[model samples]
Target: MLTLYVDAAREPNTGLSAAGAVLIHQKAQQQFKSPVFQSLDNHAAEFQGLIWALEQLTDHQDILTVYSDSKLLIEALHKHYAKHYQDQVDRILFLLASHRLVFSQWLPEKDNLGAHNLALQALKNRQTND
Candidate 1:
């Protein structure tokens, strides 16, 4: 089974956003963070972070679980949601469907601090670049 913890952060004033993910595969762990491709709200950044992590998959893991602090991401994956972000949601679903088993769970901010800090660092990197 593979576990991924993902998070995102956005600066309200700059609209600068970032996404991060911590991937645990077998006995190894990996971390990733990047500035969001587009200027998006925090919710979108969360979705994007998960997407980024899913895309990083190489060997197909039979069971994959994703942990996120974004309620919107969890709820949207569980049920039908607004059309505004249907495409992004669809992309995530498509990726999950490729795996033999997939699970999405919500984690508290405290429990997800590692990913959260990575996201903040991504935002800071963007700030430095600009």
Candidate 2:
């Protein structure tokens, strides 16, 4: 099974957000993070992170499990609807169309340290670069 852990961070002061993820396949893991183009609410940021992580996948897998700390992102994906983030939901669905099987679960923050920390680092890096 291919598993991905995703998280997002937003700094209120700087109005900056970033996405982070840890992708694992066949016992090998890769971590990645990137700053979002625009600042958004936590919900939007989470969706962006998932989108970013999904885009990083090179090939299709039999099953893909995404672990995220944001309930809105997981539920939105499952239901294919997000009241305020409908555009993001559509973007996610389009990206997910290539996969045979994909699902997301709500992960506890404490257990999601890797992605959380990476997201923070992404935000920090973006801040410094600016």
Candidate 3:
């Protein structure tokens, strides 16, 4: 199965935020990370990471699972129907359904450490580049 770990961070005093995603395919032992600029709140950053991950996926019908540390994001996704942030939520759900993706929430920063660090790093990099 392919597993994806995702996280997001917002620079202090800066409206800019970044989403980082790492896809790990156990069998192949491969990992991929996508970092993107996001213009939203923390929750929105989390959703953007998921969306970016889905967009990077090459297969729409693979046994893929996403691991996120955001409980709110996970709960939003688990709902029977999309709620506020409906446009973003709908797009994520649509990708999940279209790609037959499975998602689960993981607490404890360790589980999502890599992605979390990457997100912070990406944010730092963005700041430096600016």
Error of model 2, residue 92, in angstroms:
0.7
**Candidate 1: residue 25 lDDT (0-100):** 84
Q: Compose the digit string of candidate 1's lDDT tens values, residues 24-109.
A: 98779988987556655778777877888788787564798889989888989888463567888999988888788888899899
Model 2 per-residue lDDT at 40: 64
Mark the 10 consecutive residues where model 1 has the least summed lDDT.
34-43
Instruction: Indicate which candidate wins on TM-score.
Output: 2
Tens-digit per-residue lDDT, 38-116, candidate 2: 6567788888888888888886645888899888888888899999999989998998888788887897899899999
Rank the candidate models, highest lDDT first: 2, 1, 3
- Give the lDDT of residue 49 in candidate 3: 74
Candidate 2 Cα misplacement greater than 4 A, ranges: none
Clashing pairs in 2: none
Q: How big is the RMSD of model 2?
A: 1.3
Clashes of 1: 0
Q: Residue-wise lDDT of candidate 3 within 40-120, one digit each (tens)?
A: 577777787778778877767767787888887777777734465677888888787865557666676678887788788
Candidate 2 has a TM-score of: 0.93
